[model samples]
Target: MKKRVKWTLLSLFIIVVIIRIILAFLTPGFTYESYFHLRQVDHITKTGFLNYNDDLSYGGRTLIFLPFFHYFMAFFSLFLPLTIVAKILPNILMASITLTTYHISHSITNDENSSLLSAFIVGFLPILFSTNSFTVETLFLPITFFIIYVFMNIKRNTNNSFGKSNSLWLTIKRKKYLYLYIISFLILSLTSTLTFLLIIGFGIYMLLSLMENKKINKEELEIIIFSLFFFLWVQFIFYKNSLLQEGFSFFWQNVPSGIITEYFPKVSIIEALVLVSTIPFLTGIFVAYRSLFKLKNKKSFLLISFVISTTLLAWLRLIRFKQSLAFFGIILGILFAPFYLEMEKYFQKTKLFKFKEFILPITIILLLLSTTIPAINASLKQDTPTEEEIGAFKWLNENTPTDSKILGTLEEGHLITYYSKRKNIMDDQFRLIDDVDKRLKDINSLFTTHFQTQVLSLSEDYNLKYLVLTPSAKKKYNITEFNYLSKQCFGLIYDKETKIYEVKCELK
Candidate 1:
């Protein structure tokens, strides 16, 4: 009865998650990270294979990614429209990874309720644009979990002993496991930034490997070398050429600097937490120890080192930007799972009181979820962000002429340029310009009240005609800037909080 009930609940939760996940692709920002990625797919559908060029950019450009995602989207795009087909592909594919997490965690612990908890937590935890937003992180991060699941399952099964009853299952063919691991890693390395991340993750596993197991077999070591070789080779052939062409040296250039120093750490905090808590918190305490001991071998010291390296990398990212702490914690928590479970068992046998077992479990569960809630909130905030916003995008799409050169605010500029098919004097395609930040600052100042005072030449030189302004920008500036934009731009369109206007006109 308990098994049936738990399965039923898990099924229902999965159904709900699938339904809600649709919202991730439905309402969304017009443009975001790797925005050009989807645009590249759109071009390929009309054109041919990747004519990968960063020269479309005036600023320095670096190109990474083997265009696997674009190719993946191209396959699905055969049936669907370009934008929907390209944008929604990543989100849909990752749902499988979530399912993998639930199954993997459940199998490890042999706790049906805990598995259900894992699935619910994974499905519902908000990840800002990642959960739904069309971006690389959402599409790729879940696959890492799925890959880890495969390793764990293989480990679990191989540990079976050789005997009359178990011989059928305990075949422990080292070559087969080696091939699977190598192939999985090689394939994944082509798709995204898995190279650096998996190194950190597997390093954690190596720690576990050494703590109880002997030195890695030749086969396993060979698998590791092949995976590394493939990852580096792919980058060399595809990403490296593009960067060198653009005066770039390393792969990080492919990832914008602002992304790493400014945005990533901040965003990663929320992203890491949601992914970490996909498994229930307290269940590890009651179930993880048995599995850990069962898996522990002469090579346990290797496993310890792996755990320490992964923890250290995660901490490095966190110290650079503290949000990364959640992922580190989740991983360390998993590493410490053995102790947590042993303690749970010890306390249960102690039997301090009738309700103590229940209270302790509930307390731990609450604490874990709390750690991730801020990230969830952050994700939700990114989805809509602010209310008093025009996203001039909607108006620019509907109202602007096809070829009109207009000035738009940073958020809405790219939207108008892309969706409206207009030639913007400046758009938020940062890679397209030499001075990305300077353009953003100048464009932003145009919306404030004092926009007229700073850039009078824009009116005459750029033929600045149409303008889109949102309350969000108005509020961002102090009294001086707000007053300038309000007085100068003739209100061509206004409704409730949103406004649209032309700089050249006087309203009737």
Candidate 2:
């Protein structure tokens, strides 16, 4: 690809990202998860501390990714309302992430066309697009791509070589190779845990490296060790502080009772292996057997590394996040860019029809549909509070005092409290619950007065405020007496007419 073509692709990716950002803000993301994070952002913005819950993990570290984004909104805050910007800005940043992946993919293969294809793969992806509208998914994909891009760059250029003509591992240029590995690991720790697979790949890449200087120097070993230690230190501090401070340790449980029957059933060991390789069933078995003796040293090494590492990651994840290996599939697809380009050219030269003729259309359709179909259905099908809910939120925003805490039976408590500039006892995200056991008990207590008192006693023990009654919560948690008490003691300050009610905490 020429310089003009490269810039044009990058420019187009930026424009598509801008469009996604526009769509994200034009309407509220309207997701249960988005609202949870939006409210968390508000809590951090106002209090400069995350006090909504005592979970140490739920703090400002989310802001590391927030810098380029948050400040952009803050720069806009001279005139616009700050809360509104906080709500809209994450999606915009997500759009930028899409663009970054495209650029990175393009850089890796030195193929402008492939880069554009990967970008399109990202752009038309419905989950990725929707991810931009919220925090969790938005942060993971972009960060994952960025880390992968960094690895590819270091892989390609450590020997000071560039372009598609070379794929040699004899280039572990001492600390240059190790430095990039360490940086990739650190970035992965900061964002999503998916870097673990990438890290394993990089480690294999390092060990398989044909070191021209065969002997190791003490200095080089120390630098590599130090780089690794530094990354580990940072991750340990973050995880230990976050998890241990809340006084909980990790545990494993039996697979969900409901999972065994689903197509998504803890993607069994066998199926996961096939999915990760996309290896042609029993045909792959034959290939592995034959290749054991036929291939040269380098080919054997590369084949083994790719197969073994990918299979291990897939099996590990299939049990926990059965469908999560799809991201790994995307990475494998990108890695195939160079080889695909070769095959397309070969077929075009030999055959009557242009191999290149239908490749773009096919890739685009498959990629976009893969991403968009699920995303569109999920978006359309999701249930959120209706107009009545919005009306109630508005009413509370205008009428209630900023400091007035409310007991809301609706999930709306967190977001309402966020926008209204009040503190919340909790949000729907499990991370916000410092004591998951206690929170679960509070949830169960919703229907019975005895249970409701257990809920109220926490307020009495601390300083209580208002009780909010939503029709949804009444149906889900409580029915008669608790509803009556909520009506009598903490009378409705605002009613959404759909049966959602916000009441001031008389107990507080």
TM-scores for every predicted model: 0.69, 0.64
Write candidate 1's Cα lDDT for 321-354 as tens digits.
Answer: 3324333333333333333344456667775546
Among the numbered candidates, top lDDT falls to 1
For model 2, the stretches where C-alpha displacement exceeds 4 angstroms are: 29-89, 97-110, 131-140, 160-227, 243-356, 365-391, 397-405, 408-413, 428-434, 447-493, 498-508
Global lDDT of model 2: 0.47
* Candidate 2 lDDT tens digits, 290-339: 44445322322333344455566555433234325445444444444444
Q: Which 10 consecutive positions of candidate 2 have the poorest summed lDDT?
A: 58-67
lDDT of 1 at 251: 31
Q: Find the candidate with the highest TM-score and give its number.
A: 1
